[model samples]
Target: MIFVNAFLVGGAICVLGQILIDVFKLTPAHVVASFVVLGAVLDSFGIYDQLIQLAGAGATIPITSFGHALLHGAMSEGHEHGYLGIAIGIFKLTSAGITSAILFGFLTALIFKPKG
Candidate 1:
């Protein structure tokens, strides 16, 4: 069930992106940025949490997720660290995703050894 939900929601999101591209003539970068801002705004309104619960990584693995992670991290850190939290909060929030991407890429290269 979880896998089904994730795949369906993720595919829907991709379909939406394709629609935006075809109908609105948006670029890939613009679509990504729009999602990030939209996610941030939705998070601010406390709406994205439910969608995240419903979709899991479908909602949590995109650039929008990055914004959501940063905002959530900043708020939590700001409570404990005060003003400095704003500056470092995003890195703290997104560290897991960033580190995982780097590690996975390194491991993949070591195993595959692809060359141009």
Candidate 2:
């Protein structure tokens, strides 16, 4: 049942992205940014946490989850450390993901040649 829920929810999110690209003619970058903002907004209202509870990996595996983690970390640390915590918390939850992206991108660039 959990697997079914995860599959359905994840597929629905992907379908929505496709609709944005095909019907609304948004570029992939625009769609990605929009989803991130949507996730942050939902988290601000505490709706995203509920969605995660219900959808599990379905909700956590998308780009939107990055936004959710950003806000969640910031809020959690902000309560303890005040203004500085906000800056610190922003990267705390996302540092691993960001680091891996940079590492892989660098490695790929080293291996591949770009068109002139």
Candidate 3:
């Protein structure tokens, strides 16, 4: 049930992005940035977390999720880190995901040589 809901929600978001790109001619970067901002605004209002609870990675894998992670990190760190919270906070929250991607990228690159 959870997986089904996540898949539907995540797929819908991705489909929306694809449509915007194809029909409206929005660039991927613009769509991504817009989604992040939208997510941040929604998160600040306490709506995004509830949505995430319902959708799981549906809400956590998109660029919007990145914004949410940053906001969550900042809020958590603000309790202890003061003004420096913003910068350090995002890093702390996203480090694991970032590290995993970097590691996987390095492994893939080592395994597959590219032609220039």
Candidate 4:
């Protein structure tokens, strides 16, 4: 059942991205940025938590999940460290993913040249 939920939720998000790209001619980068912002906004309203509970990684593996991490980290840290946590906690929580993304992107670029 968890697998089913994950598959359905993840597939739905991917399909939405595809529609934006194909139907609306949106760039992939724009879609990615929008989803992350949407996730952060939904989390701010306390709505995204329910979806995360229901969908788990299906919710967490998308770009939007980066926003989820940022807000979740900020709120958690804010409790202990006041406003400073809001600025620092997101990096503390998300740096690993951000670092890995940069590292792998550099490696991929080094290996694969873009086509003209």
Candidate 5:
């Protein structure tokens, strides 16, 4: 059941992205940014947590989840330490993901050459 929910939710998100790219004629970058903003907005309204509870890793593995994590971390720490905490907490939940992306991207760049 959980697997079913995860698959459905994740697939739905991907389908939406594809629709944006194909039908709406959005660039991939635009779709990515839109999803991130949508996630942040949903989290701000306290809705994304419920989605995560319902969909588990399906909700957490997307680019939108990065926005959710950023907002969630900032808001949590902001309540404790105020302004500075907002800045500090932005990356707290996302540092591992960001670091892994940077590392793997660098390694891939080193291993592969782009055609001009």
Candidate 6:
């Protein structure tokens, strides 16, 4: 049940991204950015919460989830520490992702040979 729902939801999201790229001729970067922004906007309106409850990691494992995590962090911290908390929240929530990305990228570059 839960696994099936997660697969269906995650598949749907991947299909949507593929459709956007194939039919609309959008760049992959554009599609990724659009999805993330959309997720953030949806979170602002509380729509994303329901989706998460319904889909679990299907909603939390995408690039959109990154945005949701960011917005959620900011909102939570903003309530406690005011405007400054927004920045702090973003940093706290996203730092792990950003750090891992940089670390892995650097490691991959070091391990692989680049073309001239």
Name the runs in model 5 displaced over 4 angstroms. 113-116
lDDT of 3 by residue, 1-116 (tens): 77987899899989989998999999999899988888888889998899789999888887788777778888888778887877678667778888999999999999998978
Please give, for residues 17-115, the per-residue lDDT of candidate 1 as tens digits. Answer: 889899999999999898888878888888778878998988886677777877888878888889897776857878988899999999998899658
Instruction: Estimate every model's Cα lDDT from 0 to 1.
Output: 0.83, 0.92, 0.86, 0.88, 0.93, 0.89
Candidate closest to the true structure, highest TM-score:
5
State the lDDT at 25 in candidate 5. 100
Q: Which pairs in model 2 have colliding backbones?
A: none
TM-score against truth, every candidate:
0.78, 0.91, 0.85, 0.85, 0.93, 0.90
lDDT of 2 by residue, 11-111 (tens): 89999999999999999999999999998999999998998899899999888988999999999899999988999898788889999999999999999
Model 4, residue 113: distance off in Å is: 5.6
Question: Which predicted model would earn the best lDDT?
Answer: 5
- In candidate 1, which residue pairs get closer than 3 Å at backbone N, Cα or C atoms, i.e. clash? none
- Candidate 4, residues 19-61, lDDT tens digits: the string is 9999999999999999998889989988788877888888888
Identify the superior model by TM-score, candidate 5 or candidate 6.
5
lDDT (tens digit, per residue) of candidate 5 on 74-116? 9889999999889989998999999999999999999999988
> Clashing pairs in model 5?
none
Is 2 or 3 the stronger prediction by TM-score?
Answer: 2
Which residues of candidate 2, in runs, are more than 4 Å off?
112-116
- Order the candidates by lDDT, highest first: 5, 2, 6, 4, 3, 1
Candidate 2 weakest lDDT stretch, 10 residues: 1-10
Cα RMSD (Å) between model 3 and the true structure?
A: 2.0
